[model samples]
Target: MRHLSTVDLKVEQVSGVTIVHFPQEVDAVNAAAIRERVLRLLNNGVTEMLLDLTGTRFLDSAGVHIIVRAHGRSTALRVPLSAAIPEEGTVRRVFELTGLSRLVPTTIGLPRSAGPAASRSCSTARARGRGRKPRR
Candidate 1:
C-alpha cells in the first residue's frame, strides 16, 4: 500500500488489484498528483485497478481529465480499470454528462466480486472496454 504525501489518495492491494481511494475533492490542486500516481501504477505493471470515488464530493474538469487519461492508459496497457461512485450525486452526474460511465464500470461500491478469480474475468472485459452503458 502507498499514500501520496500531503494528499488523501490511498493505494491498496487486494488479490493483485490496486485500488485507489480518491480524496474528498479532486481538482487542479491535486489532480496531477493523483494522475501521476495512477500512471505510475500502470507503468509498474499493476494488472488491475479500481478508483474509489465514494468519498469524493467535489470534482472539476481536471479531475475528469485524470479519469479519462487513466482509462486510456489502462486500456492501452491492457490493464482492467473500474471506479466506485455513488449511484446518485454530483460526481456521478459529472461522469454521466461526460460519458465516462459508458467506457468504465462505475459501481456504487467496491466490487466484492473482485477476488483473485473474479479479477481475471474483470480484466478481460474491462481492459477491452466492453460493458453495458450506465442507465440514466
Candidate 2:
C-alpha cells in the first residue's frame, strides 16, 4: 500500500465521459494534486468529465474550488462537467449546500455501468492502489 497521505484518484473514459473517482477526502492538503490531474485531462482534449464522489467522505473549501475550477475549464473548452454523487453523504450535502448541483449536471447514486464501444482508460494512481496495471 502507498502512504496514507496519497489520495486515490481514478479516471475512466467511457463514451466520451471521463469519470474521475475521488478518494476518501479532498481538502487543502490534496486539492492541488486533484486540480493538476483534472487539468491534465482537460489539456489532453477530454470533452466530457464526470466527477464521481461516491467514495468521498469529506470535502473542504479547497475541494469545492477544485470542482469549480474544473467546471470553468470545461466550460471554456465546451466540455460538459457532470457529477456522480452518493445519495446520502457529506459530499452530497456539501454539493447541495453550495449549490454545486445547480452549476453542473449531477447524478445521485452509483456510477452508470459502461457500455461496449466506449474506450475506457483507468488512471494509474487508482490502479496502483489496487495493485493492478493501469489500462488506457
Candidate 3:
C-alpha cells in the first residue's frame, strides 16, 4: 500500500493500474476530497483505476456519490474502473442497499498468501455477483 492516509486513503500502483484504497470511513468530511483526488488521478494520466473498499468500515451518500461520479467520468473517458468490496461485509451491504453494488464492476480482494486457488474462487465470484452455491 502506498499509504496516502493524509486524506484517509492509500494508493498502490501495480501493472499500470492505480488502486485507491480507502482506509477510513468515508463521509461528508472527505467525500469531496476523495472525489477530487480520483478526478485528479484520471486527468493526470492515470487511466486504469481500482476503488478498493476492503478497508472501509462505514459509508454514506457522499461516499456513494464519489463512486457514482468516478464511474460516470471513467465511462465518459473510456477508462476502466473496478471495485474490490468483500463478498460479505457491512460495506458490501451498504453498496447493495444504496444500489452502488449494481453500478460498479467488482473483483474480490484476497490476501497474497491466498495463492492461486483462492484467487480463482474470487475471480469466479466477481464475474456474476457472488458465485453460485454448491448443489447438495
Give the count of colliding residue pairs in each prediction: 0, 0, 0
Best to worst by lDDT, what's the order?
1, 2, 3
RMSD of 2: 12.3
In order, the Cα lDDT scores of the candidates are 0.77, 0.74, 0.71
**Native-to-model Cα distance after best TM-score fit, residue 8 in candidate 2, in Å:** 3.4
For model 2, the run of ten residues with the poorest summed lDDT: 118-127
Which stretches in model 2 have alpha-carbon errors above 4 Å? 1-6, 114-136
Evaluation by lDDT, superior candidate among 2 and 3:
2
Q: List, residue by residue over 1-136, the lDDT tens digit for candidate 2.
A: 3343476687887877888888888887788888888878987898778887777899899889988999999999998887776655688778777877777776665444633222223323322234445678
Off by over 4 Å in 3: 1-6, 110-136
Candidate 3 C-alpha lDDT tens digits along 39-94? 88877777688887877888788888989999998888889887777656777777
Candidate 1, residue 30: how far the Cα is off, in Å: 0.7
Pairs in steric clash, model 1: none
Listed in order, each prediction's TM-score against the native is 0.78, 0.76, 0.75
| Alpha carbon RMSD to native, model 1 | 6.6
Which of candidates 1 and 3 is the stronger one according to TM-score?
A: 1
